[model samples]
Target: MSRHRQRQRERGQAAVEYAGVIALLLFVALAAIQLGVAAYAAQQAGTAARAGARAASMPDGDGQAGLAADAAVSSWLTPKTQSGSCGDQITVSVTIDIPQVLPIFDFGSARRSVTMPCD
Candidate 1:
């Protein structure tokens, strides 16, 4: 009877341990996913900024250059947050919104700046 009771107790112990391991695995997976998203967003922002700066570097009126830069960045970044300047040298700043996976925590926004000489 005593041995049987011990075996029954051990059965539930395995289940508890398994649940803990599974929970830990899930936490790690979520963290990895968040990191991947952040890296992707940052890369997109950098690409967008570079494209915008290149466009703005063209030899033309500042208004046209600005418009071109805005259009170039719009494909990858939100229009409301995209900013840049055009002159002897062109500079572009891009900010991208980070997707929210958790309600109580925020990963914040990703920003990138790029500069290029006018052609």
Candidate 2:
């Protein structure tokens, strides 16, 4: 009787341990997802900045260059403005929206800036 009671008590212990392991795995998975999203956003920002700088360097006009840059960037980005002297150098800036998964956590805007000489 004593041995049987001990075995019964130990039966639920496995379930409790399994639950803890499962919870830990879930937390790790969430962290990996968050990191991936952040890296993707950062890559997008860099691409947008480079595109914007190249556009601004064109000799034609700022309007077309800005538009082209915006198109090159990810849809999450809203092209702000391209400014600088005509013959000297031009600067292009793009603002990207960061998606928030957690209610308590807020990822701020991602911005990229690039400077290129006018062509």
Candidate 2 off by > 4 Å: 76-87, 103-105
Query: Which lDDT tens digits does candidate 1 get at residues 47-92?
Result: 7677666666776534453355456543544522344455567667
Error of 1 at 18 (Å): 0.8
lDDT of all the models against the reference?
0.67, 0.70
Clashing pairs in 1: none
Which runs in model 1 stand beyond 4 Å of their true positions?
60-81, 102-105
Residue-level lDDT of model 2, residues 1-111, one tens digit each, is 699998987888988999999999987777777666666776777677787678767777666656766677667556554456556887777666666654444667677
Output candidate 2 Cα RMSD. 2.7
The superposed Cα distance between candidate 2 and the true structure at residue 93, in angstroms, equals 1.8
Residue pairs whose backbone atoms clash in candidate 2: none
